[model samples]
Target: MKRILSISLLLLFNLGQSRAQSEKKIAFGPYIQQMGTKDAAVCWSTLVGSMTVTDPSGKTDTIREYKQHAIYFQGLKPDTKYSYDVLNDGSNEGKGTLTTFPDKIVPFNFVVIGDTRTRNNVHKKIIEQVTKRDPRFIVNSGDLVSNGWSMKNWESFFEINHDFMKNTPYYPVLGNHEKDSPYYYNFFDLPNNERYYYFTVGDALFIVLDSEGHRTSIPAYTTEGNEDAYWEQSGIEYLKKEKEWLEQVLKLNHQAGFVFIFQHQTLYSVKKSRVEESKKVRAFWGDIFSRYGVQVFLNGHDHHYHHAYDKGVHFITSAGGGAPLYDIDAPQPETVNYKKIEHFINVEVKLDEAVLHVIDIDGNEFDTIKVKRRDVK
Candidate 1:
């Protein structure tokens, strides 16, 4: 009897272990990306061999291949709330909430922050503050991870960003620190091959560019696989295509109430390493923006907060997303405000105007700027 009982207990224990192992989920997101007026994309990684997404109205979408799933929730109404879930083998795995973009110009709020390369504890704090605001979505200017090639870095980011990333749609630009890693590209479902793209939310047009692609030729920043050869192979082509695309996009959408461009490098930062690159990129793209009447250009890389306005354009360096802070060396006349601290920018867009607020990690607003939407006719 003792021998039989011991054998039965061993079998039961093994069965439980197998069940637990089967329950473990795959790493990373089920976050919102590529949000639109009537549809949105949800992406996640699962090794159970397939992914299934179920919406509030009981509509289900499924994908049968790949370890990662990019499921689109289509036929949704404009500016409506949606509750969604991800299931693996028909078992609930993850849940998130989202709101579709409004079809017309209306009052909306969005948060912009970046340079979250390290210091994950502080990054979590900033995310906590961001969650409190409950903005419609969040835009990251870049440097999301210290080493984008490292899976550990991405795991760390996803672990800490669970609160916000899981629920709020994230639109991120590519930072130099990202190194154009496959991990970076695989993590988000972006338009235009995830290099650079533009999207309109309400009446505001947000343009994301590949600054590192365009500015790789500037001075001492060349690497063996990342320099002229890289440019000749692909960077140059990408830059040219993006420039032409930008001109056309701006021309067609010139009547947009607001045009905001975001990237990884700053056009007017006092930081030492970025000086030459900044000048080069400014020369390359500044006139294009001015000609198109781009209202604001947002970026990260300075690891601080800065605001500058030049020739009818606003230049904002908001790299305060948990990276080590850098100070201003020499403030320019166009610099309206500067701060060395962890912070994020909140922009509230209205039909004819917009409001920008610079808020620190402690949840204090230090500055506010009001921009009137330009008449494009």
Candidate 2:
């Protein structure tokens, strides 16, 4: 009887494990982190059809199904409250809440960080800090890799903090690590033709550029494997297209309040492995932003923080995401021309002002800067 009972218990335990796996949901995020998205933005991994939007009064609004197309939620009101859920069939996957912003100049807030590869738990901790401050959205300056863009790292990244991602609409810039696989293309539904794309939030038109592709497309680097030919062997061809796209976006949103360009790799850096961005590439984009009045450029590559400016554009380099650190690459000898901080930046855009505050993983204020785009009444 003892032998029979022991065998039965072992069988029951195995069955329980099996059931857990079948129902095993990796719950990541369920918070409202994005603003200025009228109704649609890329859904990436979120199940659009399964999402349910609810009001504060508990009135639920069902999301219409999206069949195979990239997920973009529509029919939402401006600067309004809505609770949501990313469901799997009739079952639930995760939940979140969000507020939409108006088309014209509206006040908003956002956070910025980058190169969060190999530091999965760090991302989680950072999210915890960010929630306390209650900003609008988050920007990951890309390089979310663990060794050359492996699928494992990508999966590990989401596994570690799907909760934060689900809750917040992360505006990710393309980094060297994202090249690990075609998973970014498959997993993330971004704007524009390629991963290097653009979107507008409030008064800002966010452009995500690809530094790896830009650098690697040089004749010295891309004499082979020209298979990914969106442009010629020269990455310059691609940047030109991006420049043209920017011109169009600018012309289209001529009355836009601000333009912030984000990508991996800093315009200036102290990391030995990476060189200062080729002036040619910088000049092309820099001139356009200057010509069009983009106020800032945000980037990450040398897993550290450095902020500098050329002409009028503020370039913020924030690449420390609980990963190992790097030394500063100051451009000037007398003046460093860069503010270094190993923390995330919170940008608050009110009806009257836009404030940039840098905070540590513990939510400590490291630095602050406020830019006035227009006159306040």
Candidate 3:
């Protein structure tokens, strides 16, 4: 009788522990990523080992995975809104609504914001403002956290920007600070599962590349040792494959009318930190973009705003996403404009033309320009 009582007591204790663990629940996200016409990737963090995703179409999907929950809902209608619920252990953990990419070449807007590292207050404010603008999606030029390898930093980012992330799809490029961390890769469900990839929204083909993919060694940028960190450099030395891929993709999709290429590091910036890297990219990839119909190259790593036009290609550095602001070094004569402030770029796409607006953190429009599409002839 005593043995039976002890066994029952042990079982009750184990059950109590399990219940407590379940209460801890999600760490960050029940957010959206990789928003496509027929599907959308929903990602969240929890240790429950399995979760359920319920869509507006009365479809339920059971995702069996570990901490990072990445589940895709297929057969969604283009340009349609779908409300979703993320449930864990039979309890509703998170709920948000997201819309798929437009099927037709209709007018749309996408905001570019980046370098949001270790600056929670500004990042939160930026998120609030961007949410109000209600762009179809968002593009982040990397450096989402100060320490990409640390899970805590990522948690803080999601904590501050969950509202926007849960609702809108954020296409993130690889930044130097992300350091190729597995957490970075695991958190986002992007196209190709590789660091560099592309997607189309409306008539625009958005190509995202990893500029640091060529680094032969990892920098000392993480709390953990460099051995454990996952930093790389593929943009310079080992960029042959990416270059071929870029050319192939551009050749196939140049008919899309607009090609916008983005990465964490720009090929030209007033800051000296990125001068060498920029030169290499310019020599290697600049002609490719010019040869193709690439319209704009967007990047954010200089922590300031600078733009220029060369050979029918518009180069923009919109890296002002709550990171420490940098003073403009020697300004280049080719620079169309330069600004030292926290800001984001809003790109409004029409059929024949695209408008780029640079808005500061104080809700001020500092600069705007319209780029006419290049005639393929």
Candidate 4:
């Protein structure tokens, strides 16, 4: 009788362990990534381990770690919608839909939002609005999280965007807050080198640039006077290569009907403090946008809606995703419109033209811009 009782207890202990192991939930995502005309990837993560830390002030916090998983699909038909389940266990948590980019020129729409760093409630609301629009894809101008290194911040970001991101292919620009963290690259599956890349949906060309460049720490021996030069020179080679690549891409894709470029920092600013920095950035890019006939240049970081027109290029600052709004202190000469509000842009790519509807948080169309198709021969 004693031997039998011991056997039963051991069985119970093993069963409890099995149940505990099975209870590990997905940390975040079963999100879509690297969507193309013939291929797509589904990505997700699960908790691996965690550590507890106690601050000097006696405040304790728990930091969790996660492992990412992805599955790629190829030989897919273009302009078709497909249902995917990362987990085949009949759970809805891992189920989502994806649509491939059209093989030929066709009508489609996409949403653009920016600076979704803080203000979770506002971010959630904006995400909800974006989902309602049902864009073919989504572009986040940058600053997706307050701290890219913080797992908690990423958790919140994925949680807020899960429903929409699970279905829509998300493209993110590298913002200053990202800090060139490996987490950003790990979480996102993109095309080309991923830092600064280009994609196409039909005849519309979308180019994303890395304005933040590589985040390098200044050496302790460096003097304050040379700090700026050090920082600039650190990423000069990378930026130069990217600029050359951009010029090549633009030249090669000159037949594209529409071209939209995105970066984290603005080239034209209406804010008093950032105007000079914007000018410097503009100087760097020079006549690239106008020369390439790029229709729109979109960015984040300023936390407001600013539209500036220069040499036929529409420079739009759509950073009001969730961060605190900044006052438009000094409207530039090219400023077509500026608004301090939480908003997103829904762009409709038609046969002959692309129309951008700048909608505010309350679903009001405060601004609209229409650009005719490039004279593609």
Candidate number with greatest lDDT: 4
* Model 4, residue 284: C-alpha shift (Å): 0.7
TM-score of each: 0.84, 0.75, 0.83, 0.93
Runs of candidate 2 with Cα error greater than 4 angstroms are 1-18, 25-37, 41-72, 88-92, 147-149, 214-234, 272-280, 284-286, 333-341, 374-377
lDDT of 4 by residue, 1-377 (tens): 00111000001111122456655345688898999998989888877667999999999999987777888888887887887766665567677888888898989999999999999999999998888889999999999999999989999999999999888999999999888888999999999999999999898999999998874899999999999889988988888889999999999999999999999999999989999888888998999999989999999999999999989999999999999999999998899999999999999999999999999887889999999999988
Pairs that collide, model 3:
212-233, 212-234, 213-233, 213-234, 214-233, 214-234, 214-235, 215-233
Task: Report clash pairs, candidate 1.
Answer: none
**Over the full model, what C-alpha lDDT does candidate 3 score relative to the true structure?**
0.79
**Candidate 4 local Cα displacement, residue 260, angstroms:** 0.5
lDDT by residue (tens digit), candidate 2, 225-337? 66445243446666667767768876786665666778786775655445434343465566776677777778887777666666677777788776667765545322233
TM-score of 2: 0.75
Candidate 3, 1-377: lDDT as tens digits: 00111000000111122666756566677888878988888888765355677999999976544367677788877878877766533344566778888889998999999899967899888888787789999999989999887666887888898888888988888898998888888888889846899999888889998777756464556556554334323234457778888899998885777889998878787887667657766776758887886889999888889998887888899888899999987666668899898888888999899999889887789999897765553
Compute the lDDT of residue 334 as modeled in candidate 3: 66
The lDDT per prediction is: 0.80, 0.61, 0.79, 0.89
> What does each candidate score in C-alpha RMSD?
12.1, 13.3, 12.2, 8.5
Candidate 1 lDDT, 279-352, residue by residue in tens = 87787775898888899999999999999998889999999998999977867667888988899999999888
Q: Which stretches of candidate 1 lie over 4 Å from their true place?
A: 1-21, 47-66, 88-92, 214-234
Q: Is 2 or 4 the stronger prediction by lDDT?
A: 4
